[model samples]
Target: MASKESVCDSYLSLKPEKATIIEIIRSLFSSDLENERFIESSEEGKLERKWIILVSVIVQWVFLYIRVPLAKIGDVLQKWLNLISINGGLLMLFLNWLRGKVVEPDSLSSRSVLGNLDTRIELDKSIKPENTRYKAVLSIMAAKLSYENKDLVQSVVNHHWKMKFIGFYNFWNGYQGRDSTQAFLFKDTQSDPNLIVVAFRGTAPFNADAWRIDFDISWCQFNKVGKTHGGFMKALGMQPENRWPLELENDDQHSQFAYYTIRKMLKDLLQEDENAKFILTGHSLGGALAVLFAGVLAMHDCEYAWLLERLEGVYTFGQPRVGDEKFGEFMKEKFRNHDVRYMRYVYNNDLVPRVPFDDKALLFEHFGPTLYYNSCYGGKVLKEEPNKNYFSLRWFIPNRLNAVWELIRSFILPLVKGSEYREGWFMRLWRVAGLVFPGIPDHIPQDYVNLTRLGTLLLPKETPKVQHSE
Candidate 1:
């Protein structure tokens, strides 16, 4: 043991060698053991998928265009590569823009949804209900909210039995990248009389940076209160600017217009109807916005905090982790004591909830009491691992792999599996590229909807009381 230790020490002390420029270049760019692990975990499957696709593409081309032999597959693959090169970055950008822009009937007040800010949303007050489990009904309604445009939004409300259409307020905004915000108001006629819900939409996959998984953040504050739990002068130190996350606090180009606007609207709403019960709900990006909006209302400096106190609950599907530990502590205390039910629903491996990657510098944290939906516990609350969070550099590769699998599952796999699906090679390749680059498909709103449905879109026969807010 002594001899081995001495030899090891001698080897460690003898590193007085310099590398050639070639060696430096190789060290910088070469794949290592970690890279090998990544290949075993992810790239191998991708390679298998790629070969399957190449053969399929060749067979497809030969059948449709040329009666070429199987030996000519390499030529066909080269030709496809040439075509992709011709299309290049601009084509990918345009395709991304197209994918993110979900096609829905136009908003009534605005000519086109993605084209302008919408000040108004049409309403229908004629709907009435017959024995609906309110929160369960709302769960479905929230999912519907994500897929429709302003024009079709009213139709959904009119069709549901649990809620009455109040109105929707649309604002074109973004904190860092461009996005549109909608504050959907609905009267909970079935469960809580005079109840108002403000549902925010998540990222529009077609919007700017919809697919961007970048963790870049600007630290700001949760509220105007300079109060921290502990400091020198007092037990709780005050952060005048809140010193939270800037990107989470503000999403628009200039100001927090959506926050202030909704604040006023909620104030006026509760003012007119003293019995009004408020709930904030959103999915994906809208879920994050909903948290920010709630934070704005929950902050100490909020003059209209009284108006916000009536907030009955907050329900977010696949919500991203919002702020650092302090901000999270603030949110925990604020929402916990307020008789607010912060019921966050997470679908199986839904990637949105996993992101904004928790960093000490960025300080993104998931506010809990999460409802783990899917066959896991039959859609009941997941009680495991309280007050704990998980984040590791190990997740990136698998997430990318999942993202790619999701795209292939969406389009290519169906074709290979002999499903009644048909799509050209251009689209298949484009979707694959989207998966490889952004993996936004892993977080798409449609998957959440399907997960919530439990293998069927039928409305529940009875409202599951599990959804009711305290």
Candidate 2:
């Protein structure tokens, strides 16, 4: 393990599990944050920093307390849903149950909470490998599919998509000391030179730890590169003890770190086929990791320049801000230097992309071109999405009205857009929930999947290049 002294100069780490409720409250009023047991800061920080840290710690602490129960609830809910799915809908399920002929769901079945919500596992046949928008369409599907178990992902890749199923990984997080991050890789053999995609899994609905990562505001500030989200860094396999080393020694007893293991695999794979290029993609938290993977490759440019050169693009859906303004600028310069294309997809009022609050207090900001799409799947290339901060009262009524339109659209879509575009009851229920909180249903993969398939037609022929004016 690398020593703390060998690590970067500045970092602010939050350990909510170590903090007591009284200590958490006391942190709000106290100025000496370095002295707090739950916090490990390189220097004394501003009052605003304390407020952000306090909120993060409180949220994480709450999540830590509820983690087990929340997971249990998710497990039970998944099993029950799978049970219904196995018997072919609720009506059939009840009939079969009464007849004692209902089938039990397999432990590692195709059913998932996210899958249950959208219920569309197969790719759109209308969008083929030869289409101009094929890569983007395939990326969103892979991102959506990453949320499922290995067996299901493999089945979809090999059987449905007719692609090579590389592997699915659950990598170790050094900070959390657990296998928390997940990603899958596959090759699009239908295309020339074969495009490889690395899709990181997004946050699960009932996973408290995943939610904690989204809420954690801890950061590590590099000298010239600027501060990055600590939670995201850890999820991407940044070691607290050794920090972000380019290489790690092999140990059969130890678990794999995402960056190291994935980097090694990509290096080997690319070596075998020089013509092949790869894309990084994800949704929500996974999106953060996807871009950060490229950023880290830039950080070690001398060693990983080849990898960056071969990186075709990064496609993210409903991704949040990962770093400060400086970090954004750094990434923009790097992408420009390498001529790498980055398309960030945001659907309507999705709240994930608008956060860790892009304000004077918090330093997190998003870079790259956002392919913004509305609830109706209308597309626009913009630097940022509208309603930059999602909590404003002015847009509340409009958001609710849009949610109403979405719920109505759910019923009418199947009739107009063909049966393939049909949404399940769970998704319709989520749209109903969106009536109260509009962003919730908007952030799902279903809309993103819809956008990639339909938004291409709505996009103008002459779209603008990357905007860095911000």
Q: How do the predictions measure up, each by TM-score? A: 0.53, 0.94
lDDT of 2 by residue, 1-470 (tens): 11222255677788888998898878778878778989877767543556677888899999989988988999899988898888899999999989999889774564779988877777777777667677778888899998888898998899988989998898776435354688999998988889999999998888787888899888887666778988988888787552776665555412477777778779989999999999999999999999999988888876888899999888899999999998898888888888788888999999999999998867788887778888888777778888888999999999999999999998898898888788888888999999999999999999999889877444332324644322
- Candidate 1 overall lDDT versus native: 0.45
Residue pairs with clashing backbones, model 2: none
Stretches > 4 Å off in candidate 2: 1-7, 45-47, 175-179, 250-255, 456-470
lDDT of each: 0.45, 0.83
Expressed as tens digits, the lDDT of each residue in 111-203 for candidate 1 is 222111111122222223332224533653564364455555665566644457776665533222223455567676654456777877665
lDDT of 2: 0.83
